[model samples]
Target: MTLVNTMEYNKDDLLDKVQEDAENLFRSGTYFCSEAVLQTINELLGKPYDENIVKLASGFPIGMGKAQCLCGAVSGGQMGLGIVYGRVEGEPMKDKMFDVSKKLHDYIIDEYKSTCCRVITRKWQGDDFKSPERKEHCITITGMVARWVANELIEDNKIQVGR
Candidate 1:
């Protein structure tokens, strides 16, 4: 059965469903920061969970020591924006994608006050991954980021209609 039929959901109920889905995804092995954000966006947009997106996000893990230039949450938001507003070669909307990315970046930074992993996890810099406090903080912040993205996309009418 389709997700809509199984859940008996209308557009108005999407946010709660998305939040629940995001929490579930987080509890699952897909705890990578970016996956949480992507899952939330997919659920909000009524898109089926895509493995490719998860796989792409798996590459980003602050605790894993990747220490990639971009924050995982920001990367996830950009990915979501790409899915929603990106374009192929010579396709229109390239500029729109950049604009949307900027918006997502601004939103993330505004919420967290800083996008740097080091800044966000100053309490456990070298071993934050090993501490329960730090782990919980990561989970909480990631969830907050996911919820913020969902709220923004929904408010801005960026989510596709009739998914």
Candidate 2:
């Protein structure tokens, strides 16, 4: 645990919060998979960009508007990585941005066999997208992706745990 503002901040707690918030946000319909992940990470990072920065990830849900190409959660994870490692004017670019992005892709692919939304959700093909099982699966992925990014941030020292 690290002390922040005189309070003990536990890294494990932060990771749990990231996962819970991301899952709840999606379950509450406040945001889709991508938006939830984006929103959760942005807040975790202290809102570095504008409040509406999550808009950048809006179109990524449902595998790019139901096209079912890339996993929406993965897309959101990539955006989260960019928010931390993105290139800025007059600032040196972060090489870890590319490295982490690819790592996320590879991680998802390794776990799901493909990063495509349709592929990840293949077990729900005949079921309604809004079905509880399908929703739970997506919600689980959203939470996992958010936690993964938070863990990476902690490991990279980009975020001070117990902040």
Clashing pairs counted in every model: 0, 0
RMSD of each: 3.8, 3.2
Query: Candidate 2: how many backbone clashes?
Result: 0
Off by over 4 Å in 2: 1-7, 89-92
Tens-digit lDDT track of model 1 for 22-44: 65566565666777777566645
Model 1: pairs clashing at backbone N, Cα or C within 3 Å: none
lDDT score, candidate 2: 0.86
What local distance difference test score does each model get? 0.63, 0.86
- Candidate 2, 33: how far from true, in Å? 0.5
lDDT of 1 at 107: 74
- Give candidate 1 misplaced runs (Cα > 4 Å): 1-13, 63-65, 160-163
